[model samples]
Target: MKKLLFAALAVFAFSFSNAQDEGGSATSQGTWLIEANTGNAMVGSTAFTFTSQDGESVYNLGLDGGYFISDDLAVRVGLGFGGDSAADTNIFSYRLGAKYYLGGEFPIGVDLTGASIKDAQENPLWLGLQGGYAWFITDHIAIEPGLRYNLSLNEDFTDEGVFQFNIGFTLFL
Candidate 1:
């Protein structure tokens, strides 16, 4: 009877230890996040640039990073660049934002975004809001799909608002 009890207790303790090591919440304080996006919104930022396929060539690239300030909260910044070949237009983009994770998975954020266009008189600015779910594929990797809305602060340069769906890849360190 004593041997059986000892074996059971050992197995239970081992299992508990392994479970604890299986990577706690990625949104926990002190974690770092690096992200990229494939969609309209720039990775890690609220900024969006114009892209069109109306017989002209357009390309954009963006990257962003964040550091958790407290449990489930992070401040992020990102930069993006884009150009239209046919129109001979170039855009430089920037974003600054804060994100909060709900229940450690659902993320919501608000940000400020702006773009400077070559030869353009007015720079476009926007206030952005976004929300999404973080689907963790590994201990440190996540795929996030979200919706974002950017309200144009300078409507003279662009539309009143832009709505987009974005998919983001993230690494939590």
Candidate 2:
């Protein structure tokens, strides 16, 4: 657990440094976010048992930094901590991804992520892909709705994959 926390902190620190070096503003370049999601198993026979009622609710707190590579494109890196009730699970994740502005105040994008979780007595690593659309309500606030599919890579856990529906609010800076 300590190791995982250390690694997550290290990644966030590195991203912060990079954003600073690039002269990124707190509101335009860096963001703090809060997200909530419900996850269900979508594959195999387990699908039948994975209803919204049986699903787990997860909450996450994270930081994201946008590095503009072009007017409509930006590279984004985010790190977060998450918790869920099904198993009283704790997760730490870091994502390196990109976003594209769709000629509006809001932008739509896709992200691929790698995550680690400690649930009950097991620790597992996961790789996931997600896509979302964000509506920038203001210069510092935005709302995003997304979907995620995650595959577990290591053992000490069950559940082969997770299908998640997410809604998040972000405050830039």
TM-score of every prediction relative to native:
0.79, 0.47
Q: Residue 121's C-alpha lDDT in candidate 2?
A: 53
Residues 1-173, candidate 2, lDDT per residue (tens digit)? 43664465445444443333334432343443323222343221111112234576545555565665655566777666666677686667676666665653445555555556674455555566666776665444456677766676555565576777755444443
Residue 149's lDDT within candidate 1 is: 86
lDDT of each: 0.74, 0.52
Record all residue pairs in model 2 with backbone atoms less than 3 Å apart, i.e. clashing.
none
lDDT digits (tens) for residues 110-140 of candidate 1: 9898888888889888898989999977556
Q: Which candidate wins on TM-score?
A: 1
How many clashing residue pairs are found in candidate 1? 0
The C-alpha stretches of model 2 lying farther than 4 A from their native spots are: 1-60, 82-90, 105-108, 117-127, 151-159
